[model samples]
Target: MHGGEPSVHFINSVLVTVVVALFVLWRYRLAILGGMRRGDSAFLPLPAERAPGRAVLADGDIAAREQAMRQRVAAAWLLTTAICSLPMAVAYMVAGKMSASPTYALALTCSYMIAALPMIAVSLAWPPWRMVIAFVVMMLSFAALCLLAGIIERSLLGRPLSWKILGLVPLFFDIAWNQLWMAGLFWLLSWPTRLRGVVPITFAAVLVFAAAPFAGSRLTAVLAATEVGTPWVYTLGLNGVFMLIALPVGWLAWLRLGKLAADYEAKRFSDAQLLARTWWLMLVVTIGFDILAGRERPTFALLLVVGEIVLFPLVNHWVMRWLGVAKLAAAKPAPTLLLLRVFGYTARTERLFDRVASRWRLLGPVTTIAAPDVTARTIDPGDYLRWLTGRIDDLFVTSRASLDAKLARLDLAPDPDGRFRINEFCCRDSTWQATVIELMLRADVVIMDVRGISAARLGCEFELQQLAKRLPPQRLVLVVDETTEREHLKAVFGPTLEQVRVIEIHRRRDADRAFEALVDAAGGAGSPPDAWSAGKKDGANQAAP
Candidate 1:
């Protein structure tokens, strides 16, 4: 088609593959490495002993800091959402061929609002389904709003309302295709990690990337019937170009991810820093998309819009860090709240943790034993990646001395969003019992969710016994649901069951009440009840249900 310049279709096809590959590695990282077995590498020698620094704060100062941290995080979320919308606003102006006028300003403002709505809504939710529901509801609402706005504008201008408004329905599908392939690529990445499961699906995404140009040309041929389909040779050349570009790009990102993962394991980088670095890499790749946009590229507008959406979370993260929200929360230490739950309740337990941590700052840092099933939901991508690479043989502490050292090195620091970086005990089957006992002794307050507990889960039964034996009645909160085996609780806790705060969570409000009870139990840890209650009253009152 040209002497030197690549066709827009070829450029965009390559961009899509590269973006899909990067995102798979970024967001679905745990899924990719889910199949790898734990390594058996010997533990490295412990680092030289150093006293951990302690920060002292007055009760008033602690409350003030917690309040200030929440405010900063909220501000950062709003500001980042606005900032991410700018790329889309400018894209609309450029693509629509509009000048800088009141009309353009209105378009920009509307675009900003539309782009910001879903993310802001999702951030307020705890459960994964709630987040998805929030996003979908906002998108549908925005679509309706757009149609109404268009109709009103056309009527004011004495113009007819055209059928083009109906295109919005298909437009959603178009955007959804982007998310679909991102999901597909992620799923494919996971398949190859499993030795036996490796098959054509592992390479399907790569092949799709390579064939994107031919696919695009075929669609163009169908839509514009007069135009010729791309020649087979041209298609092969585009595929080669895709491989040439994607291989090195993916490899470089892979190596960077591996290094970051190792460094995170070694504690060379904090979770927030690892996230910041990863996002910066994503931004770099996205910049490459803009560079490919070049001059008069038709796909550039949609590319910009999609890129803004992709970068929204990253921008929010960086904004919060820049605003010192993480630092503020990390400044003062509180008693650790140890969490245990039934293995089946992975998603629900994660949501509960989110609720408890987000609602009250007085609960301090949350710690838990990391079951493999919960790794994807709980652990940082870097550590998960390291585990996948078989570089984490020392993941679980094998001895009491080693366990103590690990505990001492725990980073109780919260992330930029104010969720405490969970100090998870990555324990082996043999070591988990000891790990639980140690953690139980150290934990200021314990919340064990035995919702689905039964005779089948002997491990949970053991945990229940340890909690009852190690922790006092006020220091532990037992969460049970209807599915809980009444006999197990009666047999284990016996007389202690009456004194223990047992909260049954069958509904959302029950969970909220349970969360409050958990926080109150946590207040019993190392702080006078009145002082803790006074400090947390405002936060609890304002907390989202």
Candidate 2:
């Protein structure tokens, strides 16, 4: 008796909108989880590249350039990363059902919206449309690959078309789409061409697995999609199981980073190789185990920590080592007097070199031993190291008396010139820092007051690297406050501490042990710094004399 109108048909457009909204929400959660930071720009690029490493002219202060670069990164991150596509995705998904065919409706938004951020990601990170084209090629290639795999597996296994359609076919399609999802961020990352293939592939795998809800098969998927309780069952399918897998994966990755840090510290590898291995492993783990299964448990926090191990190093290159963010941090926000410099004759080329070497060497042998890298503008790793390792209590003493005792126990060699060449500097009259370094280098019986210095600060590492190059670890009495340890130092410095001689003085009894500790740490009766002692008596005594 009652018939539906033939001219008009209604679909659950509201429901479709709700689904799109959910998808957008999920993406926002992921983006926030992954990259929310103090200066995040969400979807925009930094205003400019970080400052130049060093000033090319008095006209160009590289630090200024670096500031601009950071701003650009922040802005771009905000403008493109998580914001733009999400709102649009929700809008289109919501509007699709009410407007027409649900499939077409979503395609209109999904195709265009999905392409939006990814296009930006590739362009910014790699430039020249190289990665963009690469992505397209890779996507097509992957689709072909899946088709080939399906043909092969189908033929060999002799599985029914039902199995092929429901299982393998969907799996391959999922993987292909997942890759596209991964390639969406080249602009955001500014990655090299060489590195794209693996990361996107891995990312694709993770996404497919994560999207298990939508990828099952004809009967299974339809039931799951519309059966209300099907989602609950499917979610239960592997999330719990994957949590167990994720825990160990995260742990292994964390250990790997530590080993890498050590290898670099000990000069056992090149920086490029060191960083590459770390990155490759992380990418694999991020996609293979971390992304899909990781999100389902507290393991994500652990994964975040592991991510920090990788992220810290990158941050170091972009914002610290090359960006010189540490220099900026040390910069007196108001310009009070962080850098003590002296100009003219005060500048000792050797001593200045020594200080620079000492302060930064802790970053690792990769930096210290790498081919000389000079730039007009660059970020240094100081900020990055500090952020990752925190402060390692490398130096300490049991007691002041013990420290004194240790110093007394040292085989105090007679200073023929009453001075020691602790380090060399190319100091100049105008550079007060050079003047100070020169004085320190020329002082005999130098007591390295490593009081507040943490391995995180490039300052201590720089000094230590130079010391290793110059007098050896023994001649330098590393006076720690007694609350430090070798492991703590090693953790902070990665493997750079292999050459160090540590002495902790928590009590006065340790004093007599001090001198012997240094020599022992240095590995023998090495020749001391090549400089005479400061033989003059106290200022008052000299005045009276």
Candidate 3:
């Protein structure tokens, strides 16, 4: 034989057989583990607890229903594993019988199929102790089959059985080598991070390719010494090809197993439905691989591999859609209300500002004082009466402005005298600053307007500093004129001004633009009003033209 070649056909057949066998092992291991955790019995039915005409579920009844649901999921995974493995088992049997030489490759396929039987039985609703016993029995059965096949092959070849037994030593090493790497890959993938899964799979591929030559040397030596007929170089080459193919298949199997366990734990669907879907999908892959493995034509086999890659994801998507087990959608957040605290000098100035602020209804509801008294503590009785009348007039103006802004009807808090209560308090009062801070904390958004101002009062500056320190920068909106230099604003407001959102209003035309910017900075308002309010005010001046 050229280059000491045994047979390319035999090598291809062995590669295909081992690939299917590994899939079976991976799938059933997961199935058995999932079944064990679901408990041993079906959920008992709950006693009737509803009234004659109404249906009300008790706590215990709910628990019973949940238990029943889990049992069904466990049963489905187990059954699916069994049904899926059936085709692979049959394929192994047929391939072994058809082989002309009854080589150790055929024996390996038969032995693996035999080993999988106990695992399938354990997956089917067995208790923990029984499952452990079944696993032990499986290991013993595998060893016996391997020994028997080796002895039979040696006898037919007129060679000593000891030589065949020595070859079987490498099978143990193969199992350990594959298991060690897979365990490491699983551990890395299960790390708690966004790209944990992606990183491990990539790492596994790199590791496999890098370590292939060394691992292939050991595998080839063992097989060649055991009279498997293939030369060391050809055996090494075939092993490299097999590992390359197996890596992806093994990774996918691991992922599916993980998903199955998660779904079973979550009770996302009934077990029967999950089982049916898994079984059918597994059957398709098994049959496809079986045909590809037996193909004498390299071109057809390559085409089949390409088709499997292209079609699998589409099939999986369809199955997930049909099962109603697609990824969960993100929840929509609730709308927020923005509280506006407008600061200015006279009742006229506040009224003009209120008209501009009312347009902010598009963002959210705007709350502020109908009339702000800057010197309430120093005013005489006569002056108080004049201030009260001006406040009443401003309230009417604000109501009309709210209507124009298309805001819902204004619902101002009124005093016993039927006047809208002013949020402003005497700056001299020691506790007034604390009250202001409390209000700021309760508001989702706080706006401090210093338009047309040359300098801020000590009290206003204190309030701004407290707001900056307590509230997040994004939640505070600072409205000023273009004349307010960024450097001066930062100096007057302290370090907090640097973080607060600043919206500059230089002219009447800039009012709308400033308001829009404020809304954007404040993250926008919740629900908009259906219609604007319609109240009439006397002696109200129109906003600056």
Candidate 4:
């Protein structure tokens, strides 16, 4: 081998290794950082805390800052890789890798770099549709490069140029198939996080497999033309062996990576399982399409179709059943006590309450029913009646007299299980006050989130007042952010604040402990009496404040 060939081989191999390593590192950088923060053995352990003599930063703040820095560094590294690919390709060509005039490899590499730049730039936030457009641009760019390379090669060979350019079809298929392979591998490794939508993966697989037969034929033709000593069987066998080795290795690596991610983020494993199901379905469909549409043996294809028709449903059902089993095995037992969550209806407040609730699962299933906004206009009588009847027209009342008769017929029965089943009221419905009052009067425990309350909340404050009057103070657990002023709490509850149990969340970190304490306190309280029927009658007559 010549010096140039060795240099070409070295550069190409280094480029491939570097790209793969960097891509994997970028994809899992967050998980790796989390592992480091958690002192997992897989990641480099953090340095010991500074000596008492030295000023020390909070470990959480340090970890957060480091995570942010790592994310920026990863993004920069990926951007650098895309930018450097072009120069590396040029160097490869200069090393005589592109000695076959018109340099298809060089063209392909340049086109890929061009396509990769925008993708890496937006990979973190771009939706699936945008990714599809980006891939289309890449394919078009690659085809253009191939056509240009083909023209140049023909000119160099002193061959008469004609519309024989159509002969580049094989090269197009080859390029497309390779792109699909790159995309598929990236998606497989990235799994649920990097690719949010299933459509792109499905389309890419379909296109690649559709082009595979033609690409395979083209490869065989090229091999024969080159008269390489290797037999076709040996070449095919080598590819089979490579796949057989690579698939298991790749799968194990993916699982390991996914495990790290799931350790860092609870939802990652569930998302991965969902994406796996989607990919499996895609694979089955792709294989069926190939057999039915591409195979030459019609009878065999028909038989295969018939068999698939019978087996696919069974296989699908089995997979679903297995998923359900896995989920049950993984889940913790459901809590016995059901706690109702009442909070200011804002995104920030809801998220904070949800986070707190999730941490205090021992408390029970937290049901958040948005308290009615009495500041809004009253609901139409027709809508109110519909809501009152549970959206059913079982009692047809044509006139006001008949409607009154139906109202008299209405039964305000309490839940027999004493389960306090509170319907999720629509935000637009102003009659939610009556529903909230009914549920609060019957709830075992009421978790009041008074974090951002400055003045009294119309519906919530009134409900709290009623709850304090009817239910014991122990059953009403008030959650206030430390930042909330004492004056604000007094304004909401008046002098009755002395009786209720208050849990103050001093910081985000303290929320879990505060919530857990609230749960314990709430659990000790006796269940409220069945006040729904009495409360409903009173609530029907009273106007919402």
Listed in order, each prediction's TM-score against the native is 0.60, 0.23, 0.25, 0.32
**In candidate 3, residue 479 scores what lDDT?**
62
Quick one: ranking by lDDT, best first? Answer: 1, 4, 3, 2
lDDT of 3 by residue, 83-163 (tens): 333433344345435454444443334332332332232222233355468556655655566566667777888986555
Tell me, what's the RMSD of every candidate?
10.2, 24.6, 29.3, 23.9
Query: lDDT score of model 2?
Result: 0.31
Better of 1 and 2 by TM-score: 1
Sorting all predicted structures by TM-score, with the top scorer first, yields 1, 4, 3, 2
Which ranges in model 3 have alpha carbons more than 4 Å from their true place? 1-344, 361-363, 369-428, 452-459, 482-485, 524-545
Name the best candidate (by TM-score).
Answer: 1
Residue 110 Cα positional deviation in candidate 2, in Å, after optimal superposition: 23
What's the C-alpha lDDT at position 119 in model 3? 24
Q: TM-score of predicted model 3?
A: 0.25
Q: Which candidate has the top score in lDDT?
A: 1
